[model samples]
Target: MAALEAEIARRPGHNIKRAEQALMTAKAAVLREFELTVPQYAGMVVLSYLPGTSGAQLARICAVTPQTMATVLSNLEAKGLVTRTPSSVHQKVFVTKLTRAGNALIKRADVKAHAVEDRLVAEFSDDERRLLADLLERAIKVLNG
Candidate 1:
């Protein structure tokens, strides 16, 4: 562990490069199955988390601004993949739902991404996965704060 950490300290670019590679790999796989960019795919994944989740909530979850979420929603809706309705929870708020096509797309993306995700974290145990996720969440908070 110490040796690896020392090496990583000297070659710090590996961290960012690996992250980018993973993103690119996932993007390529998704593109093969659906016509969505990385950000659009991210929005779709966020939408899948809760079918009726508000766009503003999704924007926060996906670390994007509301306007970017709106654009992504526009593209997804145009493709007949999602539906937006005036929220009963709030008069002016719109809740987004994945349409049949959107559900199907998310499922397909899951299958396509499995290999890449597995490769990325194959070394982690269940506990390690949890810790890694927690640490990354913390880092995101620190960086974005």
Candidate 2:
């Protein structure tokens, strides 16, 4: 029990988790003003960048299951933020794009979302930021391996 406690205290992953929670909480609060959840915001961002992307592709890019992305897309559609058209090539697939309102909302929300990331790295120098990113990638690779 003592060893486990000591290991937990020494682990940096806990700090990473705490930081993630803080970042998400801050973004969620700001996004709520625009009637967006984190996943919805993510979907809008991807759609804005890659218009006509299929839901399955968006699901892969957003790292959510197809079912979850479908729910998010449904909600966005209901809000008139996006439109999904049946694909010409694939009957089962639908291509998604932002409505004008969605584009505008995503643009507005992007400012707020980026602010959170800006605030997160506000204290770091350019070199330090790059180093931190590299270190995180290395850590992720090691863990995944």
Q: Backbone collision count in every prediction?
A: 0, 0
Mark the regions of model 2 whose C-alpha exceeds 4 Å error after superposition. Answer: 1-6
Error of 2 at 122 (Å): 0.9
Query: Which lDDT values do the candidates have, in the order given?
Result: 0.81, 0.95
Error of 2 at 111 (Å): 0.8
Off by over 4 Å in 1: 1-14, 123-131
How much is the lDDT of residue 104 in candidate 1?
A: 90
How far out, in Å, is residue 115 in model 1? 2.5
Tell me the lDDT of model 2 at 101. Answer: 94
Highest lDDT scorer: 2
Quality of model 1 by C-alpha lDDT: 0.81
